[model samples]
Target: MCSEGKTTPKIVRGEGGYVLEDVPHLIDYLPDLPTYPNPLQDNPAYSVVNQYFVDVNDNVAQKIVVHKSSPRGMLFRRAGPHQRVCFESDEVHACIVTCGGLCPGLNTAIGEIVCGLYGMYVVRKVLGIEGGYRGFYSSNTTNLTQKSVNDIHKRGGTILCTSRGGHDTLKIVDSIEDRGINQVYIIGGDGTQKGASVIFEEIQRRGLKVAVAGIPKMIDNDIVVIDQSSGFDTAVEEAQRAINAAHVEAESIENGIGVVKLMGRYSGFIAMYATLASRDVDCCLIPGSPFRLEGKGELLEFIEKRLKENGHMVIVVAEGAGQDPTVESMRSVDHQDASGNKLLLDVGLWLSQKITDHFTRNKKMHINLKYIDPTYMIRAIPRNASDNIYCTLLAHSAIHGAMAGYTGFTVGPVNGRHAYIPFHRITGVQNVVVTDRMWARLLSSTNQPSFLSSKDVEDAKKGATDAAVGRGE
Candidate 1:
């Protein structure tokens, strides 16, 4: 039988599976659905939707009823007007918190956020969440005000205290929702930013109106988007200071050689920048450089020659410098330090040991190996003026971005310039090794060590050979 409405084939259940019967196409048979009346037709929500309609009250006397369905069904009535009433109160029961490793300018960032919100924005009820995400889930919080943040900017560590672990994003969101917090400012590194973004997304998904902002913080300065991470400049400055100290010690000790290791696990920016700043480093070993496991014997031979010829050696090695095999082996050994912290496989220490062993084999040579680890010292110093200013700008930019409803973003300086970039832009950006051009420039620079020269290598070999001959028994 032909269909009565439209002209197309429609599916019909038959004795078998299904059969196609003649029917109308969708466009020919479809009927329009009724439009729902807006609940806030007389309020701001009506204006926001920007729809034009005649008032039905005038026709009500005719005894007619209008039936319609909303996009959200009966729940459409709850989509109220976007009023500023929630933010009008003087008591802002909100808070700011920081978590993770100590990054430079952390305290300053926190202080600026609190002061900006409370003093300028007039948000008074501010609290600090201690121990990071843990503090968010745990029952640990401290009230903060303008006065409380005044001295905190000068501090190095976190004012609210910090813990490495605790609550996940959903848990923190649930806790904050329960506490009636309308907004939160999270100051932290990449991990913390990820957590904050997840929480923000979850809150939105749950239909809650809460704003969250993240300030980029990391000593590694590896966070993408910002020109530089918060603690990077400070770390570089501290490294330079330590390098300067090492140079002075080397000169004072007369014929003394010192090997100092700087922190830069996957990238050698710290070592490179420090080498550039400190003009006396004899040799700087960084990841991605020409120095590798295959070249270790040659490097040790070169170092011995430099010590014998110059009477003093100064080497700056990145903490991440070394061959993959040695580093991997060290990791497998599960070494631990006195503080219960995992003792990282230090490439500088390994290189130093190799040099020491090489010099020892040459009994005639009197070379002393002084290994100075500046990792802790560099990260613990007070932030320099440049870093503090940069961090303040980053924090301000982050807050402003949040206020503007930007999400999944990072604020920091890039290529020595202050800029903000999307977090997703660098979500999987690889940390490449230092390029060969940079390596060549560093090698040729008068400020850095010329230890790879032929003369230096020859002298080291001679020293080792002589020592071996003298040790003949």
Candidate 2:
């Protein structure tokens, strides 16, 4: 089933006892390809380690805490230096491209990839695709080396500029073939990973000796099959600063209300985590949870009650919250950007206005409201300590997998262990905040209403959001 790319993903499996979400290898098709000793076997840095090469059949279990009667469940190929490799040092020509919007660890990921290929494998002749998918055919390539990327990790955003849409798979594959590129690295969010999957399919259909590797990167931490993605820690850390500022402003005045809109695309992870960390947020709103500003399940009434108790309150809202057609039907936008994403209503601005109107005119209460939309700021900063370390692990894992001739795979931590996941298992998938222990913790910290029914909470745990904030389908 893995050889033909027909394995069911673990998260969606209902009745299956157990499954292996294995990735593809060059030997699956090019059976006659010769092997070479891993370059790491002689590297001094690795000689100090107790164990290095991972066994070929080694895998990580996706679910460890199953019922006594349940099977071992899904497993993914463990990521590490393989005992043997297929690509020789000189024949490996690699090109990297970053797509979608800015993420905190993008530059760090790019830097680690370049350094891993150069320092460990001694692979020269690496190219950086200038501007996402279109960069393959439309723009020039930048020569990448350890020296060039040495200080990039200290910077923010991708050194290789990114963009949205304009994903021409044919032309991009053609460029790969024309340039004799055998290894491809793509870094992006969910939509970009979907594009990478199509590119992998094309390469497979053509029977090319190419390896396409995806680094699952979404600052929202909404990609499925992984415990968490890079940039999430950094985003959460940066978001706390905004929450702190908002708290200061709210507490310093009478009848003060602070509204902070966080980025979760179609989910509520960022808002949820930031609110939990702040400890001052009185309310939090996210998608898949039914919330109404007005009605029997009134959020405004709760806000009023909270203010009466504390004299000040902070509200944290996910970008995807309040997106119900019934709430925003008249203002539902039909326009899309170049990436073809549905332009969502700015819930922050509208909520601010609603709060202002309800207090100043509707209730005849004078109030001071501060709305902070740190959507771009949080993601645009450099990677934090934890995320930088995470980026290093992901980058090296991807480099090792690609160099060992693994293709059509994405690298990420599954159950806190790095593993090579197939493109089919993760593409078009989204991970949402569930009413789990963590959500319960957030509720306790914020002391806010559940804002959702039991069924809606179940729906939130179903999976990732279909429509991202600014990216395409």
| Best-fitting candidate, scored by TM-score | 2
lDDT of 1 by residue, 349-466 (tens): 7877777765677675766567788887777666789877876776655544333333344454443433334333323212323333555677766344433446545654565455
Q: Give lDDT for model 1.
A: 0.59
lDDT of 2 by residue, 1-473 (tens): 00223433434233455456678888878889888999998999999987789988788887778688767677888999987898888888999999998999999989899899988998997999998888999867899998999999898888899998856788888999999999999998777777887888788778899999999889888887787878999999999998998999999999899999998877688888888877878888877566877766579888888888999999988887887743464456466766666667788888888889888777656789999999899999999999999999999999999989998889999889999988776655453545568778887888888878777766665532433321121
Error of 2 at 415 (Å): 0.5
> For each candidate, what is the lDDT?
0.59, 0.83
What TM-score does each of the candidates earn? 0.70, 0.92
Off by over 4 Å in 1: 1-92, 293-297, 328-343, 414-420, 426-433, 436-438, 446-473
What is the TM-score of candidate 2? 0.92
Best by lDDT: 2
